[model samples]
Target: MGKAKKFRGLKFKYKVDGINKQLTDKYQTIEEFLEAEFPKNNNPLSPTGDTKIYDVTWNTHKVSINKIVNTLSDLRKVLSVDCYVTNTDIRLEKIKPRELERKSTYSIEQIRELTKEVLFEEDKRNAKVELDGDIIKGNSQRYQTFFTKGIKCVCCGIEGKYFAKEKVYRDKSYHLNLYAVDENGKEVLMTKDHILPKSKGGQDHIDNYQTMCVNCNVAKGNNLED
Candidate 1:
């Protein structure tokens, strides 16, 4: 589904990583190693034994060098039936149409065709809309409560840099925001509360702490998913 890759040895010119590198580096038999991996939009290398290279979604940094080799060995197990290393990109094969016609399972292309049809009708669903009045008031109520309730982070008590416990909320208050009273007698200080956070189960109940200071609470957005 990502990019086209070539099967080694099927194409004489295309080279596997270590296997081809020795030839190119030691004997200078080839100018460079032909990168053969799944073709993503970024790479130009092809598996057809041609010299073109291509980009694949696999990020080299996130995976260790040994892990990369291990993954390649794993892929080699099913490379022939599941994927094709191409000269321009890796081409993966879908289930055969004849097999789909005879099977009870949903066809592989059904989602693709449905997505196309939905996209075509998107404008009809976007017909029209209207709204009235603006609501802005109870913005920072819960955030201010953490310090009010005197609760601290469960892991580390409020003593230092992991200051959630001392403050009962998260803040990189190395920089503090100053608030001056407005002409209308309103305090212009606006902050948010962090709800059930990534550190916790992330429940949205009142049990969840609110963080004030837009910058303070948002530092822990859904990023916990990472």
Candidate 2:
């Protein structure tokens, strides 16, 4: 129903370092001198990989906050990522967006829930069905559209029989491909979206379907409150 969620990445490196005057003061044990010069470097990307530690002399000993921000800002300008001069800092410069963020129209679990919910939501609405007294037409045949057709996104073009249920959303004139066996192998006509929506007095038991692309489907959202 909405565009796929996007990820916003915010990243920059901090020094996490200190000063070194080891040349002026000599130490007998190399371990003592090394510990004092490079106090923190225990981070390991993988357990089996070589560990790298940071040392004071790695830079000009003048890596400023402003400099790091400027570097990150330059990268943001080049890569077209979001950047800013300041956030909710303690002194109006400390707060910043988290290093990485992802936005979603639905959560993973909600998506799983909506996989079926979006399709079924229409059928459950208080919309009335035309019928003869004590006799409902096509419910029996159309209720079983899943078994008749197959599970796929009736909205987006992504297709597969991976839907959780087969029968539930069949009445929607679901999106699909039309196929037939040919002289040797087979022939397939691309499936299509409905030019008319069933909710807008269109036939639920239609004999023809029109393939709708993702952009078109989304663009046509809620024409029948689609």
Candidate 3:
């Protein structure tokens, strides 16, 4: 016979996606959030709370699969929680990676329905947005890749287009950062320029490039140094 199930009953593993802060901020902490959302009897963590009896990591929580499938479908989609049946013979390591994985043994129809629901909720959230000046602010996460690398303008030290307004907004709010505008408060266009002149045999590549505002780029055109 197959080895006895690790869990006596069906088990589910879950992790919440951290993206929209407004939705997450509604709950002060992760523990509070889970307690309020899940049944009181299922206490995701141990009584002492120092260690998780069911969770593999701080973020991953475990529950009886029946309880979640019966009750938490709507909540899971709203919170963007990724959950899967954990007592299955198959494992994630056995399958190719998926952008989003459905519960093991779920039908293709079920997966499609769940995927549609998630997409609908995301589109609904994205529809609600407010612009701040030149910035098209929204719940969507962007600039994450560059941020990981600490990309910033070498000249003005401006981190990003969004960072510009946050740094220079005065009174109520302004559109441009101090470094992005001139003395007259006019917007300064920006571009990539060569630190060593291309005509002077500097290879045309990113290694030779530097960030420069339009005014600075034009003023220093064809010259090796500022």
Candidate 4:
């Protein structure tokens, strides 16, 4: 729920751009005018009517005067009166528990509590697992690979720094790794191939996996019968 604001204890300073006898006669000072227009306790102004004098015109060159000062000037300007006034300090009224009335709907707290109860009831339907806050050990296939075991490809003596994909396999089901040295003497990758066709119900499991250079894999792809 959004909070409603009540302003109080505002201190204002005012100056007129030009003299106007009609406004001057009604209120001699800006403070007096504000006090009369917004009486204590009756309006948003504080009952104490605290005020102080201070100079705020330090940087007139950089930016225009504060909005509060300009707004006061504009209000009087509309009535052919030119004035510069600013409220220095304003206190926000403390928020109290309030109920908005429409003569139909529930209060804010009632809606909030009901929403929380519904969410909790929905959460109870989810599966619950016992967590002792300790890391549990499990055998993941990712950890059993040559990449994890620090083993080089069976066909290539050196493990390449990159892995190349064989496109002739009809789909990118797996990657084959071969090794070669570039002119810079850096280990380069070759394509890995499945000894049996995966489309022919061949397993990508460990025992069936084989590494082949790109050239060999492409040659095999052309020679193998459909």
Q: Where in model 1 is the C-alpha error above 4 Å? A: 3-191, 195-199, 221-226
Maximum-lDDT candidate: 3
lDDT value, candidate 3, whole model: 0.33
User: lDDT at 72 for candidate 4?
Assistant: 40
Give the least accurate 10-residue stretch of model 1, judged by summed lDDT. Answer: 159-168
For candidate 2, the per-residue lDDT at 56 reads 14
Instruction: Score each candidate by Cα lDDT.
Output: 0.26, 0.28, 0.33, 0.32
Clashing pairs in 3: none
**Candidate 3, which segments miss by more than 4 Å at Cα?**
1-179, 223-226
Q: Which ten residues in a row have the lowest lDDT in candidate 2?
A: 54-63
Off by over 4 Å in 2: 1-157, 165-195, 198-201, 206-216, 222-226
Which residue pairs in candidate 4 collide?
A: 176-191, 176-192, 177-192, 178-190
Candidate 3 root-mean-square deviation in Å: 21.8
Comparing 3 with 4 on lDDT, the higher-scoring candidate is 3
- TM-scores, all models, native as reference: 0.19, 0.19, 0.24, 0.22
Give the per-residue lDDT digits (tens) of candidate 1, residues 1-226.
3444322212111234422211111111111122335464423233322332111112111111221222322323323333233322333333221221111221213322323333223242332121112111112223234334333332222211111111102222111121223346543322323365534554534455433333233343322110
Query: How many clashes show up in model 4?
Result: 4
Return the number of clashes found in candidate 3: 0
Candidate 3's residue-wise lDDT over 117-160, tens digit each?
23223453553332232222221122211222233445665433
